[model samples]
Target: MPKTTETTLEINLSALTHNYSYLKSKLESNTNFLAVVKAFAYGSDSVAVAKHLEALGVDYFAVAYTSEGFVLREAGIKTPILVLHPQPTNFKTLIDHCLEPSIYSFKVLDEFISTASHCKQQDYPIHLKFNTGLNRLGFRASDCNNIVEKLKATAAVKAKSIFSHLAASEDLNEKEFTLHQISTFRAVAKNLESLIGYKPWLHMCNTSGVIHYPEAHFDMVRCGIGLYGFGNSANEDQNLNPVASLKSVISQIHKIKPNETVGYNRAFMAEGHQKTATIPIGHADGISRQYGNKQGFVFIKGLKAPIIGNVCMDMIMVDVTNIECSEGDEVIIFDGIHKASTLAESANTISYEILTAISQRVKRKFLK
Candidate 1:
């Protein structure tokens, strides 16, 4: 990869391939792999990532919304796409696109069945989302009989998979709660299978569960962050690589004398002579106001330059006083080596927020 001359998000397909293989290695030979490519593939180019993963033989793809799946379909993604959350309004559009929906509630399930029936569809695949412990969008484990009853009354929909989300599969401290969730999911799958008279794909593990709990991998595992990097633990993180790196170039350099203030609100007043670099990325570009006033740093010429003052909407001033860098020099916002997790930590957040928060306007460059 060449040095970035402007604000760019580099998506490394090779890194994605490696991450995918690493995650797949933890699963059984017959287990399915569902790649979660929502939120613009965690703010990298979704089409590019999905196309590459499709070539790598991912069993399925999961997106948060129907529109995301539509985008994938537009990109010619042929593998099955599971829309994790589908609104009643998009049920028609979802059916038109042949995207499967996760039937979480009786309302959503009923609406989808009606939509599918009205569309004259038969046995349209839909995943059953059970609320084991996430307490988010899912049907209760006790709702198994209701789901069975609903399925029996309709040929418009079919339960292709039964799944749930692990609230804290990455946190070992929540092992007991996680275990309970797993058991509940298992019981639901068993009861549902008995009632439905057939087996649907059973999955509960997310990225962290793939790393921490292989026994819960079940029939399929949905991996999101781990596929992009950061394994939710220091030990596991060492094994995966981040697929995206946000880079920019210094737009200008400023030489400030003692007592000179910089940026909005005079938030940073130089105590001594300082040199600052204004990079073309800020709150609007996903650098966020939270990472201002020396709370964050970017790597320039392989040296750390702390952000000096308030983060502007379109730019930020970093104290590059000691660095021997010039205008157009490459600036590393966060890369595999620097790690978005570290920058996110400095901002009192996590890797997911920073990674997915990246602005879509940033020009994407891919490393094949």
Candidate 2:
């Protein structure tokens, strides 16, 4: 048996595979599935998630940095890893590990080319990123000339894939805007292809785009949050199984008198006589401090327990007055039943924030 901790992060691999297959079914057979495993696989466990996705025959894996890609390489992951935000400082390490970098800006492209040449590397695969509309990291669509010029001039670097990110693929209200972005990307891609005399694998849609605009399934689709089984909108199908569950044991229970205060700075005041359960989890464990003051809740004995006071670095007090729970009983912060969405909503955030915000200090337990 695996060693038990005060708090447990349960990763359901079967659910992951199911989610992958679910997204795969939505795309054409020719469309490659690229799994985004950055942020430690959305703060679950990148190595495990990447391994599972690799075993499930995912065509590619993407991470935010070279270090994340290195982790997969060390784990013997043979799948191509695209570094979404590759830095020049890590260019050597990235080349050493056979990791591909996404050339977002001209500066990054030059740095990568220079580094690869210094290392005596030849024709290293690299993905080109177009900004489209995200306003984040990516080359501007109008700047295709510069990209094409560089690629044509440089024989040391090779274009593996060309891609862009959708800003709001899930919002139907933004459908018109999304379409414009898609059109722009398509035009830029066509121009680049014509200029380069070759068609690099083109991908643009994210998880939300894959569901809402299936036609945008270009050459590949990147799925991140969806892989953990949460749709972009509640209106979409809810068949995707949630892959992660968080459970923490109540370490202490106390009966507070009316008008008593709880936690640091007395953020939560008792309405009446209440029983409070202190759990061994707090912001330090990924639960945010914004969830303090009874705004956030957890499941105890199938009942809602309002979190009281400030979510400290190491613990959180819950108003468990009516719940039939004990010191050693498990409390569900987020699971299939509670839904990570519910928690994020309570904290005025999205499920992505809640799931990815989970701290690294907590233990991860994988369930196949």
Using TM-score, give the best candidate's number. Answer: 1
Give the clashing pairs for model 2.
286-359
Give every collision pair in model 1.
none
Candidate 2, overall lDDT? 0.90
Q: Candidate 1 — worst ten consecutive residues by lDDT sum? A: 1-10
Native-to-model Cα distance after best TM-score fit, residue 225 in candidate 2, in Å: 0.3
Q: What C-alpha lDDT values do all the predictions have? A: 0.92, 0.90
User: How well does candidate 1 match the true structure in TM-score terms?
Assistant: 0.98
Candidate 1 segments exceeding 4 Å error: none
- Give the per-residue lDDT of model 1 (tens digit) for 221-330: 99999999889888888999999999999999999999999999999999999999999999988999999998999999899999989999999999998999999999
